[model samples]
Target: MDKRSLTQLTERFRESEKRTEILRQELAAAIRQAAADDVPQKDICEATGYTRQQIRRIVLAGETETAAQP
Candidate 1:
């Protein structure tokens, strides 16, 4: 491939990677919030546009926040 084409492809790949990372972080945050709020995985999936398996995985990864003491 030409240098210009190669550069374009690299940039596209980088952009996609960045987007994926952002989504992953967002999903993690959503899962944590859902857990903190006692929301079900199904509800979190609906709210966050993530699949059930993705939400389950995020929850299973132990992203829950501890309850704050008064």
Candidate 2:
């Protein structure tokens, strides 16, 4: 492949990674909000298609980051 094409592909891949990170943060925030609103863990798991452990970790991680943000 031409260097120009390869560079463009690399840039697109990097953009995709950035978007993925933003979505992950949004998902974590949504999960934390749902938990605060008294949503059940099972309901969260079902809605998010994540295991209970995964949902718990996301919520805990979000809380930790929020607490550290001043």
Candidate 3:
């Protein structure tokens, strides 16, 4: 592709990735709530397709980001 076309494609892909991260964060928040409600870690990992450690990090990161917001 030409430079102009490549630039446009790159911008579109970046925007799509941003949108996807929004969904991912939302999912993390929901998973955090589920865990708080006594859901097992292994069950959460199985349902969310994230490993146990990844789930912990996601929940912690989500909490940190939310706490940082006004």
Candidate 4:
């Protein structure tokens, strides 16, 4: 309701958006690196601090990309 509160909320939202973008880029790079290196999902997970399931999903997505290429 107050101007100060509104400003704080806007700042927090901006920070969250920036963090999300950084994480997205990091995830994409990790996926690409994993695909290029032919690393195992578990190793990717360990290196990237992602869970096994997340690593699997990323690797599978990379596989689909490779499959789609001519």
Best by TM-score: 2
Q: Which whole-number lDDT from 0 to 100 does residue 26 have in model 1?
A: 79
* Candidate 2 residue runs with Cα over 4 Å from true position: none
- Identify the runs in model 4 with alpha carbons over 4 angstroms from their true place: 65-70
CA lDDT, candidate 4, residue 3: 100
Candidate with more favorable, higher TM-score: 2 or 4: 2
- What is the per-residue lDDT of model 2 for residues 1-70, given as tens digits with 9 covering 90 to 100? 9999999999999999999999988998999999999999999999999999999898898888889996
lDDT tens digits, residues 1-70, model 4? 9999999999999999999999996787777786688887767777778788777777678778879999
lDDT of 4 at 11: 100
Worst 10 residues of 4 by lDDT: 26-35
1 or 2: which has the higher lDDT?
Answer: 2
TM-score, predicted candidate 3 vs. hidden true structure: 0.73
- Clashing residue pairs, backbone N/CA/C < 3 A, model 2: none
Which portions of model 3 show Cα errors greater than 4 Å? 62-70
Query: Native-vs-model 4 lDDT?
Result: 0.81
Q: How accurate is candidate 2 locally (lDDT)?
A: 0.94
Sorted by TM-score (best first), the order is: 2, 3, 1, 4
Q: After superposition, how far is residue 12 of candidate 1 from its true place, in Å?
A: 2.2
Report the candidate with higher lDDT, 1 versus 4.
4
User: Per-prediction RMSD in angstroms?
Assistant: 4.7, 1.2, 2.5, 3.1
- What is the TM-score of candidate 1? 0.61
